[model samples]
Target: MEPHTGEICAHSMFESEEEELAGQAQAWKYTFAFVESLAVKSVVLLGIPDIIARHGPKATLSLSQIAAELPSEKPDVNCLFRILRFLVAKNFFRAETSGGANEVRYGLTPASKWFVKGGAAAPSVSMIAMLLMQNDVTMMAPWHHFNECVLDGGVAFEKAHGLHLWDYAAAHPDQNCLFNQAMACNANIVMKAILSKYEGFQGLNSLVDVGGGIGATLAEIVKAHPSINGISYDLPHVVAMAPHYPGVKHIGGDMFREVPSADAVFMKWIMHDWEDEDCVKILKQCRKAIPETGKVIIVDTVLNPREKTALDPSMGLVFDLAMIAHTVGGKERSEEEWKNLLKEAGFPRFNIIAIPALQSVIEAFPY
Candidate 1:
């Protein structure tokens, strides 16, 4: 071969090897990713943040002190010490030199601060813990037979539980209450950002929170702007036990059947819980419910593949799989997909407002 050709060939071979190594690294990383999730859950379950919070701001407590505060019989303190080691590595907590033998002194990191009890701007520790638990064996048993669900083209949760998620919730009041509380806890974090940043509710005389669980989001909106009259629309069963929130009315109904008429309809994390056709049907109902001059507010994640950010595509993909496992036909959509869905649903214009939270607000107006 010519000298120049030999150099090109060598460079090409080096590049291929580099790519292979990178691919192997990523594969290995993902294969063991479940360990990190479990570690997070262990800390949350042990109430490490709450324990640290009780110690007061910037106060560090020795492992023995922490053990004394926790229930004496349960939560083996030694085992908890091992978990705290991982948490320290993850930056959820920090270890400081206390005495000669390096006693584990626990202090919160910015990330762990949100898990602290009664802390303002704290992310829902209970909710995160619940989701992590769902990822455990009891809840994940359904997913093991996901192939059967795919073959039957049915919801995996139904296959495992002998009933749909909604049905199971209806039958088991305690589980239903837990589900709602988990959802509400998640909503609190997202709604705080929405109410603060997004001005979509401005100038709207009336609003409807379609599929709003227990009226949490709407309550926050109503509380923020007292003039905005709101309604919570959900299944009769789901809304039956919904607690009353001042300035908001609960309308127990189906979205596929009808949406209560309003100047603006708000759907937070609702559309992603259904398939495209179902979403279109719900959007059509929403379009019909709202006046021509009004709008439909959608709070969901608009997966942006092109946008370079720390948020990975895997997060959206995992949620998509989660929807497939639990809901009948739920999904997370991209910005382009949202545009197409809106256009097909007969809405002419829309606006995308990115919130600080996990979801984004998409406001669509009828022509």
Candidate 2:
């Protein structure tokens, strides 16, 4: 709570001459990339974004003011400022152009606004859970064994933790909380975009959210479209703790074996967690859960090589490698890869609906 004491802020250092040398700047930047993630996580954990937002859009919090909002009254203000400086450079927060630590006031950026709990686009578990998960000691430990894993065809995660991801999460309640919370937060944000922009859910009468975790997304869907009855489907243990929402039923079962029958089956961020063969098996199971007119709607990012924006394909690429590093056969896929997988799964045809928010929807129909 006391700012984690002192450590060298390597990212703050700069070199004028050698950085200009070919790949030197880029390489050094890459080396210190972990600092950016850590710094963001630190700020989020310390409620920096929330404090700034509480001060209102027009107001700003000075370094001392921000520090006061944190856990300790006697925290080292200078160290906090150093972290703030890194965040400012990363564009997560904005500081005044000409002011000392005492005078410089920090304010939330457009991006940081989402970190505020009750803000317009606030997601309860998004940043904190995601940041912590990526920088997790357990998850990072596997990277050290990646070379050995490559040579031996062993799993980095299994090598590090002595078990696979799902098994590890099941055995560890704390890690499971992180994964579920992060997933729920992501669903909250992405579903809002889907409901606001997309029209595919307009006519569906019944829907089942396959691999829905605690049913956050389906809860949102049921609320948005009250006419549609929703089933929050996931593993037995997950549904046992799922929150009860009106018009939404939580059913416990294995998706690979059976998904509850519905007019539409929803799978968000699921296929990316498995290889093509496994993905096809899950899709085929979903197909069984629907009738002749039914469809399996995929709510996940479509890796695009054509356009680059807030949802960078590069970020998706890192996620792909991360899947390789952490899970058995999980990885992100391109549109072509998705289509081929769908064909293998016995789905006749599919349509991709693009939304401006976080992920695109791939609707695969049973013909």
Identify the candidate with maximal lDDT.
2
The window of 10 residues in a row where model 1 has the poorest summed lDDT is: 120-129
Q: What does candidate 2's lDDT look like per residue over 1-367, in tens digits? A: 5575578665445454454464576888888878887788777888878777776865688887888888886898889999998888889888885455347888877777766665533554345666677778887888888789778898889999999988898888888878888788788778877887778888889999999999888998989889999999888767766888898998988888888999999999888888888898899999998999889999876787343446655677787888888878888888898889999898869988877554688899878
- Please identify model 1 stretches exceeding 4 Å from their true place: 1-31, 73-75, 119-133, 136-138, 148-152, 305-313
Model 2 lDDT at residue 276: 84
Q: What is the lDDT, from 0 to 100, of the residue 186 in candidate 2?
A: 82
1-367: candidate 1 lDDT, tens digit per residue? 5456434443455458778688779989888877776787766766777777776758788888888788666658778888888888888788887788867698877777766555422554335535554655545767767888767677788778888778877888877777787678778888887887898777878999999889988998998888999999888888998998999999998899899999889998899988899999999999999988989999888786444435565677777777876787888999899999999998889888877766778989887
Against the hidden true structure, what lDDT does model 1 obtain?
0.80
lDDT values for all models: 0.80, 0.81
Tell me each candidate's TM-score. 0.86, 0.89
User: What local lDDT score does residue 261 receive in model 2, on the 0 to 100 scale?
Assistant: 92
Enumerate residue pairs that collide in model 1: none
